[model samples]
Target: MFGGSDIKIDVKKPVYELIVEHILTNYNFLHKQVSHHVDVEYSAVLTGLALGDGRIHSAFKRARISDENAGEIAKKLMDTNIVRLLKSRKQFTSWVDDERVSDKLLFTTPFMRFWFAFVAPIFKGIKEGNYDEFNQRYENKIAEFREAVFKELSNELVKISFAEEKVVETGAYWDREVELDIFAKTASKKVIVGTCRYTNSKLKKSEIAKLEELANRAKIKADVFVIVAKRGFSSELKSLKSEDIRLFTLKSFKSLL
Candidate 1:
């Protein structure tokens, strides 16, 4: 069992090491009784899960483990009680209820989140000596990348919209049909909706219009409707402000941090 910070650290350790360290720290803080039992391959998966944002499929993909190896990896993790294998394809497919895994904490972490989002998608490219395409794809999705960055700095974002009463639940929200890149709800039921735009382009009225429509449909009367853009807002959009709308650029968001 990995306990008491006995894990070795190296100067040239991959990014995954940092991810594992973060997970260990977080888990220790959350539950003092928990300990990690990990090997190289399992470590890779844990690293993937920590970086991959709770996406198990992406974590497996990033570890470069084949379908054949997946079962073995799943078995190891499950046996160790680090993660529970929900579905058994060998017999039949079925769902595992959250209640079963709640105590087990069978979920990936932020490191795995990034791994699945970036590394796993390009496994073939890495194997076939063609990573350019994969790299380009990552570059194209800079908006999502920025949003992840925002998620990391979400605490500060909440601080800016401080109120007399402290809010508890603050996180992003997304559903099957509708997805809000950033969603924050206070204990008092005040909600904030934010959208992220990556390129140098400014946000258009059309985008704002869509968000407004979505918010109304979702039945969220957001107290603050924020728009986070990389380049900034357009003059036209900025000029036509409503009571519910606020604008933020990448610089402004970082400043909040």
Candidate 2:
């Protein structure tokens, strides 16, 4: 959480607790990094982006700020490299309305995302040495937050796994009709669509079925279908692994190292 640090880590302590002690509780450090760049208005919009779906419309609404104000702040945030706009991969068609499809805002770094998501809103409480709200929010939302991080990392793994095929682009694909967790196009124009499940249960063949259904719904012909899970897969899913189908476990991340 502190980036590169010489501080010794205690193996027995929970990571969440350590983050609280070292990062969240230290207002002076946070202020030094953020004060020059953002004010309360900027911070509120950032917190909205972190807490909500990252859509510009949704973020503005969540922040209870006007679209004009949010738009300006979002641009400033992007200019400072605090966040980036992620456009949807849905193919533009005459029939599909572009204005209806909203672009998402993503933090440039995981630590900033974590800070806005968990620490910024409840900063007053933390500043006062009260951690009940922070702890409860962390306990409830950590899995969801980690799942997003896992999906981003899985994009890198996909590029590595497809070593023979150069992946030209990779990101989440979303439209008004459907949302796909992983979407990539190889240099040969082959479409690869997949999903990530950061859960303890083993993935089943039904996961593939769901992915295919989403692809069909989105009118995307996937040349490859991949499933990334926290645990391993069921025997039924394992049986179908082939050149067209791929499965990855959490252990696959070691290759990234």
Candidate 3:
């Protein structure tokens, strides 16, 4: 039973601030040693991590920038071309009204995707290392890593669900007593709660029951239930039939995209 209040997670620092400080300091230190401008692709990757996962305060703590212009500062860093842009006009034709900005800017980049998926977790592990039993405890949690990846792709998932007329609002949610991995709201005020399970094992009925209970108790409007699994549902879950319940495998999810 994972209660929202029981999850003792810390607010992490933004990766962009760290990258900026790293560039400034290293550029000064190695100005005579290196001759290349720090790559924009790499900076973008770091900024994505900072903006998405790193704590806002942490970025300020590292750089001491006032809150009034943090967004401007971040944009300036992003515009420096240290990080490569990934989205193009052709990729987002249906989503954007301004083609000029679409061509000049990217919605996202692979490096940021990679950092959010892999580097962030690894960094945490290294930071919390225990030399007494480092090797034994340092093994990565593959399931968690995969869940993070799914979180990064949540925007796309929401778009797919919307096209299917199954979702209205898609965003992550967590509070003092509860946390939903993916929350989709419908126009009728019905809520579609989903979790991304990235493993070989099938989803159990107990998990579905848990989701249902959470949805029922959530301090938000909800009417539908959804479970998105990578491996598929268990026999017990497959047998479930309810008007509010819906099941989707990863393949089915991708097909929508």
**Top candidate (lDDT):** 2
Stretches off by above 4 angstroms in model 3 are 1-107, 113-143, 152-155, 162-166
Tens digit per residue, CA lDDT, model 2, 109-145: 7777887889888888888888899889998988888
Instruction: Pick out the ten consecutive residues of candidate 2 with the lowest summed lDDT.
Output: 91-100
TM-score of each: 0.52, 0.91, 0.51
Per-residue lDDT for 138 in model 1?
58
| Candidates ranked by lDDT | 2, 1, 3
- For TM-score, the strongest prediction is 2
After superposition, candidate 1 runs with Cα above 4 Å error: 1-146, 151-155, 163-167
RMSD of each: 10.6, 2.5, 13.0
* lDDT of the candidates, in the order given: 0.54, 0.83, 0.48
Candidate 2 clash pair list: none
Better of 2 and 3 by TM-score: 2
lDDT of 3 by residue, 1-257 (tens): 01111223233645434433332223334333221433433343343343443333334444455667655554654575433332321221123233232112222443333332333333434334322232332234334534655654654565475555655566554433455666766565565666666768888998877886765555444566667777888888988847667677777656545
